[model samples]
Target chain A: MSLRLAVLGAGAVGGSVLDLAGDYGHDVVAFADSSSSAVDPAGLDPSAVHDRKEREGVVGDADPEAVFDADYDVLVEATPTTLGDAEPGFSHVERALGDDRHVVLANKGPVAERYADLRALEAESAGTVQFEAAVGGAIPVLSTISDLGAPHVTAARGVLNGTANFILSRMAAEGLDYEHVLAEAQDLGVAEADPTFDVDGIDAALKFVILANVLSDGKTEYALDDAEVEGIRNVPGTALDLAAEDGRTVRLIGEATADGVRVAPRLVPQGSALSVTGTQNIVQLETKHAGQLNISGRGAGGPETATAVLSDVSRLE
Target chain B: MSLRLAVLGAGAVGGSVLDLAGDYGHDVVAFADSSSSAVDPAGLDPSAVHDRKEREGVVGDADPEAVFDADYDVLVEATPTTLGDAEPGFSHVERALGDDRHVVLANKGPVAERYADLRALEAESAGTVQFEAAVGGAIPVLSTISDLGAPHVTAARGVLNGTANFILSRMAAEGLDYEHVLAEAQDLGVAEADPTFDVDGIDAALKFVILANVLSDGKTEYALDDAEVEGIRNVPGTALDLAAEDGRTVRLIGEATADGVRVAPRLVPQGSALSVTGTQNIVQLETKHAGQLNISGRGAGGPETATAVLSDVSRLE
Candidate 1:
C-alpha cells in the first residue's frame, strides 16, 4: 500500500505536501514546477527538497510535462488559493484527479469552487479526494462528518478565517481598529495583500461549501453563489464593550445552520467557546446527534498547517 | 449478537441513556437501581421519564419496563462520580465488565481513581467498556482517539470539565471571584456542592487516564498525578485585566505537547476557539496523523450529554 504521490504547484502548501511526503518517506515521483527547473520523468528523490528550495521557484515553477509523466499514484493539490478561478492549483487538481491520481488537497481553490467536478471525478475514478485541510488547518472535521453515523447534519459553522479572527480579537482586546490589525496581519504574511477572501467571508464561505458537501454526502443542496458574506472590516471596538453589557462577546461566525446557511458577525454572550479563543479559528458543527461541537486552534501558520499536510500524507501510509 | 444490558444507578445520564435507547428500540434487561421497584428483570422504558418524579425510591416508574428480561446486549454504568473508597459506580462498572457485558460509562470517578481495577476487569472479560460520553459531552473524542490511524498518539488534550470552564468564563467576563462563580455553578447544578474534582483538575485528569490507557493501548508512561494541576478557583481579575492589556483572554487548557503535560489557565490572545466558547466547553486533540483538532459545545448539560449517550446507542445498532 505504498503510494507514489506527485505534488502539483509546490508553493507554501504544495511544498508542505512535498516536505511531508519526503518526511513520511512515501515514494515521490517527480517535481514539476511551471518555471525555472523541472525533473525529468525518471522520478526525483523527495530527499532533494532542501536542494530544490535552494533553487528558488524550482518547485512551484509548474512544469506540467514532468507532472504528467510521473510514476505517482496520487496527486496532492497545494497551490495557492486563488479568488475564484482556481487559478494556480485548480487546473492542476483537475488534471491529476482526471489522470487517475487520488487527490489530497491542501489547496483552497479546487474544492471551494469546483466541488461538483471533483465529486463527479471521484465517483468516476472510484478513488477519493480528501480536502480536510481546507477549513481548519489540521482539524479532522471533514472525515468526522463523512465517517460518522449517517447523520443528517443541519448546519456547519465556525470562525473560518483565522486572519479575520485575529483582527477581531485585537479589536476587542487592545481596542485596535481594523486597519491597524490588517496592516500587521499582512506584514506578518498571515493575510494576503488582497485579503478579500479572508476578510470578505469568501474563505469561510468556501469552507462551508466543503463542509456542506461532505456532511450531506453531495446530496444536500447549498447556494455557493449566494453566500451572505460579511467581513470583519466593519466590526467595532465598542462591540466588545457592547458584549460586556451582557457578559458576552462578538465573533465572526461563518456557518450553514438550520436557518438555511449564513455567515455573520454574531453577538455571542458569555458562556460560550466563542469568547475564549482570542485569535484561533474555531470550526463547529451542529447536527442531529450532537447539538453543537466546537473545534478550535491556529487555523493558519506554517508549522500547524504544514503539520496538517503531513497528516494528510500520513493517511496514505 | 445480542447484549445483556443492566443499567446501574439510573440518574439523569443513566435514564437519558435508556431514553435514547427506547427511541432506537434497543432491548434493555435488568435495570439495577437499588430503588424499591426492581423484583423482575424488566428493561426500563425511557419514555415515561417523568414518572420517576412520582414516588420515593421508585426509579423506573417512568416507562413500564418496555422489554421483558433477557433481552439486553450490554450494561450501562451512568452513576454519579463517587469519591475515594465510597465509590458507587466502581461496583457496577466492575460487575458489568466481569459479566462480559459491554460497559458504557458516563461516570468519571470510578474510572479515574480505580483505573487499574476497571482495566483489569475489562481485560478479563475481553469485552469493551466504552466511555465516549465520559470525557466531553457529545464530542466523540474518545471514539476518535480509538479510531485514529496512529497507534501511539503523541498527545491528547482538551477542556474536559464543562463546569470548571463555565466558572472560568464567568470569572473572565463578570470579573467575578471564584467563590462567587462556584456558588453560582452549584446553584445551576453545574458543579456539586463540594466541587473538588472539577475545579481541582481531578475530573480532566481522570479522562486523561482513560484516554492514555485506551488510545495508547496502556503502554505509555505518563503520570497525571504529577500534572501541574492549576485550578481556576483563584483566578485574579488582575490577570484578566493584564491579559486584556495585551489583547488577550485566559483559558484553562489541558495541553500535552512535546513540552510535557499541564493543566492551567493560560493567557490566549483573542481569535481562538477557547476564547470564543464563553461558558461552554470546547475540546481539541493533537494526534500523530490528524494534527490539531477541535470540538466544542455544551460540555455538561443533560440534553447534550444525553445526546452523547444516544451516539453510543446508535453505534450499537
Candidate 2:
C-alpha cells in the first residue's frame, strides 16, 4: 500500500504532505522547487522540508523542476499562485499528467485558470488529478463534491480566502481600516506581502472557478478576470460597526451561479455561525440536494493542506 | 473492481443502492430485511425491490432470516430508525459486524443507540464500517471527520435534521405554525405519520450521539440519554413573525459537545445564510483545526441516499 510520492515545489504544503506521506508509510522519491530546479539524487530529507517557502523563483534554495525528475507514481503540486497563468506551472502540471503520474494540486492557479484543458489532460493521460486542498484549504470542499456528486449544489459560495477573511475579521473586531489590518496581516505572516491575489478576491475567485467547473453539473465556469471582485482595501472599520448595529457581521463572500460567479464583501447578521467564524476560516455553501452545506475551518495553511494532499494520495487506489 | 454487496434492508436508501449496484454490475448476492432474517441462496431481484412496499411488514415479508444467511462481504443497513434496544431492526447491524462483514450503515438508529458496543463488535471481527450517509445524509460529515483526522474535531454542530428545517422554512416564508406545517410535510410524504423523531429533535439528537462517539477521543462510549433534547413543538409561529419583523429566520440547530448535546429551534438572523438554508438540507461542521466548514445539500429521500450508497461501493477499493 506504499505510494511513491514526488513533490513539486518543496514549500509549505508540499513539505507537509511529504511529512504526512512518510508518517503514513508512503515512499518519497523526488523533491524539487523553484530554488533548485534540478532533481535531488539522494532522496528528500524529511527534516529539511519545513525550512522553505515559495517565493517568486525559488523556495528554500530549491528549484521547482527538480522535484519532477524522480521516478514516482504521483506528483503533489504546491507551486505559488500563478493565477493559472504561469507557463512553467501549467507545463509542470501537464508534464506530470503526461508522464502518467497521478496529479494532486494544492495551488489554485492552474485548475481555476484552465480547468477545461487540465481536465482534458487528465483524460489524455488516463490518470487521476485530485486537488482537494485547492478550493478551501482542507475543508473537504472538493471531496464533498466527489462525495455528493454535486447534483443538489445549486449554488456554491463561501469565504474561500483566509487572508481576506483575516483582514475582514480584523476590520470587524478592531475597528481598524482595511489597509491597516492587511498590513498587520502581512507582518503577522498571515497575508502575503504581494497580497493582490488574496486582497482583491482573486484567490477566492480562483477557487470559485474550479468549484464551478468541478463541483457542479451544468454549471458554467467563471473567468477569474471577469469576476466582480472587491478587495478589503476600502472596507471601512464602520462596516462591522454597521453590521453590529443591525446585529449582523461582515464577511467577504464568494458565490457561484448558473450564469456566472461573484465574490465580494457582504453583511451577515450577528449570532449567525458565519458571522461568528473569524480569522483564516470560512463558512457558506448551499446545495440543492443536501440543503445548506457549510464547510468552515482553516481556509489556508500547511497542516490542513497536508491532510488534503494525503486524501489525494488515498485516492490513488 | 466490482465488490459483492448485500443490502440488509430494502427501504429507501438500501433499494436505491441495490438498483445502482445491479446496474453497475456489482455482484449482489442477496437481500435482507425483517422477514428474511437468514440469507437465501437465490439472489433477490433488484428490479422488484420496490414492489413489496404495500405489503404488510414490507421488510419482514422478504424472508429476513434468509437474507442474513447469504454469502456476502459488504452489508448495507438501510432501515428506518431503530434503536439497539429494539428488536429485529437494530440487531441486524451487530450480527453482521460480528460475523466479519464490512458494514456501511445509512441507517441512523443502530449507531445512535449503541455505537460503542457496535464498534467493539466490528473490532472483534476486524471489519471496516462506512457511514458517511448516516449523520448528514449526503453531506459527507463523517468523511469530513475522517479527512480532518480525529485530532482536529472539537465539537460537532450545525443543522442535522431536514424535515424540521422544511417546516421552519415554510413558517419563515408563509407565516405558518409548526403543527400545520408538520401536517403538510406528512401529506407531502416528507414527514412520517408520527413525527416525533423528525419534529421532536430526536433524529438530530441520535445523530449527535453517533458523531460524539466518533470524535469523543477514546471516550469509547456515549449515550443519547445524556443529551438535552428540544423539538420544534415549543417554537411558536409568532416567533417567525417576530423574527421577520426583526429580519431574522428560525432554524433548528443541533450541537454536541464532549460533555453533552442539544437540538433545538433557534432564531438566527433572516438574511443570514443559515436562515436562508431551506427545506430538506443541512449546514456546517466547525472542525477544531479547519474552522467553520459548511456542506449544504439534500438531507433526505432516495437520490441523495442512492448516490451515497453507490459512492460507498466505489470506495470498496
Candidate 3:
C-alpha cells in the first residue's frame, strides 16, 4: 500500500508531509515549490530536499512543470490558498485528475470556491479526491460525516479558525482589546503579518462553505459568497467582559446546514464544550438520530495539518 | 445495498434497530427476544413486532433459537452484557460468524471481555466484525481510530458513562450530595434501578478495555478485570465545591493506552473540553503526529445506540 506521491507546495504543510510520508509507509517521488521542482522516480530523500530548500531557496534544479511528468500515484496539493478562480491550485488538481491520479488537497481555495468544478473533474476521472486537511486540520470531520452518511447529519457548526479563536479566547481571558491582542499574537507568530483572512472570518467561512457543499451532497453548490460571515475584530472587550460576568464567553463559531453557511462571533456558556480555549477548534454535528457530536482539536500547524494530509493519503490506498 | 438483518435482544437498542432499520434502507428479516422469535423471508413490520412485544411480552410465538434458521446478511447483537465469559451474547456472535454472516455488536460483553476470542473467530470467518455501538454509543470513536489507523493514535481518554457524568455534574452544579443526585437521576430515568454498572465505573471501564484492545491491535488483549476502576460514589459535595472554587470540576474519566485502562473520578479545569456537563460524553485521542482530538456526544440511548449499530451495518455493506 506504499504510494508514490508528487507533492506541490513546499510550505509548512507540504514539507511536513514529505518529512512524515515515509513513516506512514509512503514515498515522495516528486515535490515542487512556487519556483522550483524536485523529481526522483526512485523516491526523494526528505532530509536532502529540506537541506537544499534551506541552503538554496529552491527544492531542486528541475522546472516546476516537471512535477506533471513524474510518475506518481497520488498528487498532494498543499499550496497556498487563494480565492476567486482558485487558480494554480485548481489547475494543478485538474491536471492530476485528468491524468487519472488520485489528488489529496490541503489547499482550501479550490474546495471552498470551486467545489462543483472540482467534483465534476473527479467524476470524469478514475482517481478519487480527498481534502480532510482543508477543514479542521487533524480532526477527522469529513470522514466522520462520510461514515454517518451526509443525509443523517442535519447540521454542522464549529470553531474552525485557530488564529481567530486564539485571539478571541485570549481577549476574553485577559480582558484585552482587539488591537493589543492582535499585536501580541503577531509577535508570537500566531497571527500573520496581514491577519485579514484569519481575523475577518474568511478562513472560517471557507471551511464552512466546504462543509455546506459536502453536506448538500451536490444537490446545491456552496461558495464563499453564499456565507454571511462576521469576524472577531468587531467583538469588543466590554462585550466579552459582560459575557464573562454572566458565565458566558464569545467564540468565533461557524455554522453550516442545508440552509446556508454562517460564521460569526457568538456567545456560549463559559463551561460549554464550544468555549474551547486558545488555538483550539471544535465542530458540533447535529445528527438526525444520534444526538449532537462534537469534535475538537488543534485546527492548525505544520505537523498537525500534515497528519491530516497523510491520513487522506492512507485513505486513498 | 439492502441488508437482511437478524436482530437479537428485545431491549432498547435492539428494538430501536428493528424500528429504524427500514429508514436506513435495510430490512429486519428476523428478530428475537429472550423467549420468543419472529421470522419473515421478506421483512417484518416494525410497528407490528413492537405491538406484539408490548402486548404479550414477546416478539413472536416462534422459539428464540429459530433466529439461527433465518437467512440474514448481518446479525445485530444488542443483548445484555455479561462480564465473565460474555455468554449468550458470545454464543450468538459465534453462531452468526460460524454461519459466515457479518456481526455488528451493541453488546460490550463479547467485545470488552473476549476481544481476542472474537477476533480469532473473525479471522477464520468470511464475515467481518464491527462494534461501534459498544464504545461511545453514538459518537464515532472507533471509526475515527480506524480511519486514522490505530498505530497513529497513541492514547485515548474520556468521560464515557452518562449516568455517572450526570450525577457528578449535578452534584457539582447544585452542590448536592451523591445520594440526592442519584435519587433524582433514578426518578428522571437517567440511572437504572441498579446503577452499579455505570456509577461504579464498570461500564466506562468496559469501554476503555475495548478501546485498549483496539489500540493494541491484537498485541495484547484487555478485559474488565485489567482496568483500574474507581466509582464516583465517594466524590463528596465538599470536594466538588472546593474544586469549583479553584476553577476545576470532578468528572468520571476513563483513560486507555498501550499501557492499560483506568476509569476514575478526576479533576479537570471547569472550562476545559473534558468538563462536559449533564449526560454528555467526550473522548480525547492523543495522536502521535496529530496533536489531540476530542469527540463528544450522547454516549447512550435507544435511538442513539441504534444509530451506531445501523452505521456499522452500513459499513458492512
Q: Give the candidate number with the greatest TM-score.
A: 3
All candidates: DockQ: 0.27, 0.32, 0.83
lDDT of 2 by residue, A269-315 (tens): 66455664445455456654334556566777776777778767876
Top DockQ model: 3
Docking class of 3: high
Where does model 3 exceed 4 Å of error? Answer: none
Over A1-317, each residue of candidate 3 has an lDDT whose tens digit, in order, gives: 99999999999999999999998999999999999999999899999999999999999999888999999999999999999999989999999999999999999999999999999999999999999999999989999998898999999998999999889988988989999999999999999999999999999999999999999999999999999999988889999999999999999999999889999999998868788888989999999999899999989998999999998999887
What is candidate 3's fraction of native contacts?
A: 0.87
Lowest summed lDDT over 10 consecutive residues: which window, candidate 3 chain A?
A269-278
Between candidates 1 and 2, the lDDT winner: 2
lDDT, residue A186, model 1: 87
* Candidate 1 accuracy as TM-score: 0.73
lDDT of 1 by residue, B171-191 (tens): 777887788888988998888
lDDT of each: 0.64, 0.71, 0.94
lDDT per residue for candidate 1 within A32-115, as digits (tens), equals 555633443444555475476666636534456567666677776666776566676767766776777777777777776677
Q: TM-score for all predictions?
A: 0.73, 0.71, 0.98
Q: Candidate 2's interface RMSD, please?
A: 3.7
- Scoring the B chain of model 3 against the true B chain gives a TM-score of 0.99
